[model samples]
Target: MEDGGQAQRAWASNPPTAFIFLITVFAFFLPILIYFPPFPPFRRDALLETHVQVGIQHPSESGLRKSTQKHNAGRSVPVTAEGTARNNAKDGVEETPKTSTDGGRIRSLWIYPIKSCRGIELRQSRVLPTGLEFDRLYMFAQLRSPFPAPSSPSADGSGPVEHTWHFITQRQFPLLATVQVDLFVPKGEADSDKAASGAFLLVRFPWKERGLRGVLESAAAKLSRGWRAQPEKEFVLPVAFPVGSSSSRSPSPVPPGSGQESDAEEGEDVEIEDRRPRGYTHEKVTIWRDTVSALNMEAELPRELRLYLGVSNRLGLFRVDPARLREVRRCAPTPAEAGYQPVAGFQDAYPLHLLNLKSVRDFDAKIDKDKDLQELDPRRFRANIIVDNNDYSSPYDEETWKKIRFTSEPGNRKESNGSNDKKLVPSTFHVSCRTVRCKMPNVDQDSGYRHPVQPDKALRKFREVDEGAKRMGCLGMQVTPLFTNPGLPEGRKSWVEVGMSVEVLERGHHVYILQ
Candidate 1:
């Protein structure tokens, strides 16, 4: 009987041990259970429907969708006479009624013709589908790799890889900021004439030596002189060519064994007078992950620029190909569904970048606590639109503005209750996403001198935010302009000028807090 009792006690203890063992097993697989839960299949459509119900429209179906469809369908929505008059208003004056005091006025406008270069402040500017007229139209690109022949297959089995080009920004080349760019579009010239003349993009480095400037000025003068001599044809000055290739009209060459070749001889000074119909020569180029076509301005560029920019591998002035519009990626609908994609010239992301003055002042306060630092220049952000936010209490309030509608002048207002009416449609922009800032802001806009500890450090401390897989600092909002004047004929003047009132049409649900 004692043995039986002992066996029963041992069995009872064994049950406890078994229970402990099971607990250990459960603990081991807990992570798996939590991570790979046996939940119902996720239905994107249902989630989207839920989002719609909550007043969160799909990014693709924002204000731009309907207008784009209408534009694609060849329907001309007439612009009100008032709207036209407001658009034609003189710079620095508000055409809107003084009674309309609820909205913010456009404080300033800026356009950067070259990516990563200094921006030009304007009192008034034209807005295009891509962005502000001439904004990021040109970008300096370096040859990433040589064009592989068809016989030479890439290791990745992607077939022959042609020459790859990538944009060089201040992040990589801070010196680019030192290069001043001035795009001269002759006033009163017709669009066709302007295209034919090809806006003279004058780039100069005033800080550099006089010799470099002289060389550049001389080359530009020569090109301009040639163009003026024969306005119909396109002139290209060849800076460099493949070795051993002979030009039909070559400059004086060095004698054999001279061991020294003149600049002309080394580069093969060849002038191409292309009589063929004047049109941009388009070539495929890569910017970030997007491979799109760009207009190659290499042939038209002066030799001096090649030398200044270091064209050992290859240097080219590339313009965003208007024919091959680069659709805004991330938080926007696909080009096919959108009917017409919101295009950008050579912007890192969206068409327009907006920054509130209050946010900048707040940032300045944080960095320049002692007021020692030269008042932090808002130009560092390189925003296309700068809005005065003195009325708002908090900084970065613009981030929460999901959609903004720019009111036309008092004269342009039509008595209409429908918001969708063509006559009443204000210049609207859908805030696409918060701009992900990089180290480019560390460089001084005026001098291109990079500071070791600055905006970057301060940003990392205050403005850092996790963007999915990566952490980036946020400063401005990327915006896509919704078509307000669909009836305005193509190439006709339509723009948002300074002093236009901006009203918040929609607000974002979540308040983005920088960690």
Candidate 2:
């Protein structure tokens, strides 16, 4: 019996019982082993919960803060240029200065390309540097980038980026039909009595190249009776920004005598056609880090608005600084205050002189502000500084102008109050002054020139030439055009057909400068 018990114990101690038991159990439940869990599956629930937790912790890129933009309805909303505006103009703003570039505070004269449209004014706008900032920031470029002449030709001989964009005119992109441009500069809250310190308008225009179809060249040709076929079709389009959003063209104001140059032989009513813009035909209209929303909707613009002032064929306006002139306003009596009556019998004798701040580059610096004019806002014209100018100040009687030194000026941005409260000159001074005659073409009742369709017609070469002369600003005349037929077969109708001359009344700055 003891031997039997010892054998049993040894068998139990050395047994492979666990393996044998598991095999026996698995064999009995083979069908159950083949199957998965029978209860409702909650795998997806666990996964979704994890995803939500992660998502909540890290969100997508939040947008940035942009200055709140005010929208005007329908179209050409009249913007008062003086010290009064519907949105921001007030009665207490300063007046347009007439004497110097300093002291007497003056605002700029903002010019909108579209009539009655409002614009933003700026303290100073630099040219070459700042011109495109105000004007070209909103155009749509038909050609992607400046074209590289034909590079050898394509496999099918199609040509390189001959004309990149598949453009459509405002006809296709109706939203981009009319765009009003304005420069927005932010000032500290302290300067504006805690107001937004909003910007002053400089200029505005109808954005032309929206749909990547209508090009400035094509439009220019259509507007001009002058060209066609070859080079006209090859008309180079300007650089424009990307398309923005879908918005109706601003309600248009009757275009002033100055009108747009567009030519579409499709012969649709140009006035009605002016209402269309483009879609996905552009990118955002912007300059540098500063972006101005354009009325466009092109989605796939490969490039952003990169070109500023170098747009194809658009015209631009520029400004002048008040500091450039000799202090003449202190001596020249105000036309309203001085009983200054223009002589009647002298028809073209004392025609008004227009001082162009933009043309400063063309003339030699008689004074310090020549280079500075390039920085002034062409649209924001503040007539603070005056000239003995045969002159830049308001139309003068010549007799009222006297010589004087601009006094203890801040020596910075000039003003009309004689360099501060110091007066126009340190002491009484003298200067030799005189007046000259200039005239512009008389528009007749039927001069259809006023029509938006025929705006380029009323323009005269003589007027343009004289405008250039205004910048040269000599004692007499530098390049004024008469526009009379010089007895030529072609009536002096074309700007190229006119001739010009300068009649120097007084000569030489040979006189020594007296400080």
Candidate 3:
């Protein structure tokens, strides 16, 4: 009995040798298992989740469509046929059973010069085959980690990551919304020498730790809550766009009878010095699955701005390399449904994003039950074109639209003898696919803070309509300009302007392609 008691004490004091060895081994490999999981990690669709890596690898076809229904309590209506809509009337929501054909007008136009940053609203914007001019022409990338640690932590602090010039978006950093961008072109003809030399981009953002006076003013402004504070810092960057063409420096034929000094100087070329920084470093950066070769701006950014973004590493601003164009092919089930293969710059997927205003209002109505949540802001969606859909009875009627045409009706202005004015050329856009949304819209565009449960939670209730991305909810539709000769010098005639009539040219079912 004494020997047994002694054995029990010895066992308690020194566990089993095998057990001790196993624990020691576990402690040594714990980090490795976490960093590199032995089993497949819980990964959402490539574009559906925030990717830690610079570029997300394309998963297998079978894996792409896997159901990732996070909130499955709400009734889901499968979009099997054209004009398939949910009957929310039973749920105390009034819904129209029929679709409207008269169409809606373009309410607003927006251009995001920098990807995922504050966008500029335009009254009229020239439309290129790729997208609206000056839309997503540049992007801010993280060059290094702020932490002294070898690898910087992921944006969500998922794990240690090494991101060298990886694309940064609101999904990763909501504060990016605070960065404001403006294009400044000299007040003259687009081809004029002065216009080219003086064009620049104005960028502004808030900085940390203002001086004593600035701090006191900020505190006073906060306490008052009656006025808004301006950005703490601002910087100007040279604009170089239209791919290879130098800004306004290239010689263009002067307009006829411009009141210049002499007619002989009309064709004379002016030598405007190139103001862009020299020795631009080229590197490959990834936006979704495509890896694009981009030019790293040589201009040094303020350290305060980098620190404001929660990074110690220098923030690298990149422009799309002119030599390498990223072709945007349609992500559809069949070739017939796949539209023209246009090119893009720093945009996430397609060239243009169109949203129906009624749809947004309906989304707001859906979340009205939650008293804690406020009305969802349309800016959170970041759509390039917002159309007024008061004419349509049903929200999300765009889900059935396959193509849209834009036309401007001539007013009563007529030629001599009362002949009707020539009809304006109509521009058509192919509806590529339904926009698959992530939690990106959850970020407040104004405050730059993500809402805990939001339109994202409400979206899952009724917006999950795409069969391809069955798990993700869809809100807007991706569109591509249908131009016969997009590459010709004079082919760019389509202009999307506010108040233009938007008519549904075709209607059909849509299936999402995760390319």
Candidate 4:
């Protein structure tokens, strides 16, 4: 009995025995512990109970109270000039002696001469009432099926048949991005005729593999010399479309001198008038809801160009007629006060789309982390003005800017009153609406290849916003340039350039939060 008691005591006190016992127990339960942890699973109920107990003990103190106290503590502290300067330094908000130190500069300028085609970058460009000069001046279009009959009836009482045209864009043809434009502004002696005769537009398909580059290059070379050099291949198709013509055909010319008898019979002098052949074809065309007579360039387009596009498409060139200025629709800060209604060349809505460089960077960062996509390109957005803000801490800050002012010279710092301030007047553009993105951005601007999942998917995840009936992913702000210099000649246009100082005239009342 003594020996048994001694053995039991020795077993209890032995470290090696206890260690082996623990190891055996752990080995036995290892798989079970992994399958079902020994500790209770985390529960919201337990957490809430603990929180309630903590709160009861500290009833007088809460997160809200703590925040309020922190806010009030800052206000209560008396700040000296030196202390304020130190605080400002700590906060990183600079105090500018001038009106504003947040002077954003235009980093790049782009003009899309042909709708949905490749954009042209420029250091300086003239700003037309419609948009930047030559922006969206032309669009590719095709004849709509089941064409509408002409408004007028034929002499035999039969309805006049007419071919109707509608606008086509990158949404249908991604290859449009391959088309490039070269605009030549005549210099020296021809400078005064800039608007009339000196300016010429040459379009070319730069795709070398398709053998279109040579054809386009030849056409461009001929157009540069003179339109008359290639009379049969006139680069500039002269269009004499009637304002509201119902039929595609040109009106019958009045029988020669039918209005008045020969003045020679009335003992009056008869003057002979020189007649020139009408060099343009007029057609009834519709863009969106606005139907206007336009000149179709079916005959003017080169055969190789049409073949390269791989479709029976005609290019429609329409100039913004001063007589019929289209008012900006569905936008705030209406353009009615601008004396003349704001116009656009062929833009779907607002003339200018502005994008911030920081926004693009932010979007690219998200894509890199979340998606298996190639790095995004800013060219996909095709904004007219890209504002660079190196000091801006947040992306999409431009969404809060309701109005922006552009100045030629950066030194005079004056706060803009939005209108009628001569000191602040330069050129102002009002943010009309958030630009709703489409699948067009999915098509690579350089390669014309479509990504399986990209921009659209990522934007849906991060940048989706409620716009009308649909939720759209947006990246840029659509804007309209206010007519600051209304006193200038009717035909004279304004200008904006790269490297110009851009100031936020006013901030939006509401910040657009992304979903």
Number of the predicted model whose lDDT against the real structure is largest: 3
TM-score leader = 3
Which of the two candidates, 1 or 2, achieves a greater TM-score against the reference? 1
Candidate 2 stretches greater than 4 Å from native: 1-119, 123-128, 131-135, 144-162, 165-177, 182-455, 464-515
* lDDT of candidate 2 over 411-434, digit per residue (tens): 432422222242222321122222
What's the C-alpha lDDT at position 392 in model 2? 21
TM-score of 4: 0.60
lDDT of each: 0.57, 0.24, 0.62, 0.56
Q: For model 3, name the residue pairs that clash.
A: 146-312
How much is 304 displaced in model 3, in angstroms? 1.5
Best first by TM-score, ranked = 3, 4, 1, 2
What's the lDDT of the predicted structure labeled candidate 1?
A: 0.57
TM agreement with the true structure for every prediction: 0.59, 0.23, 0.66, 0.60
Question: Can you tell me which runs of candidate 3 are displaced by over 4 Å?
Answer: 1-101, 144-163, 188-198, 212-228, 242-279, 298-300, 332-340, 368-372, 390-392, 411-423
Better of 2 and 4 by TM-score: 4
lDDT of 4 by residue, 229-287 (tens): 22122133212222233232332221221232243453343332223233346556677
**After aligning candidate 1 to the native by TM-score, how far in Å is the CA of 219 from where it should be?**
18
- Clashing residue pairs in candidate 4 (N, C-alpha, C atoms within 3 angstroms): none
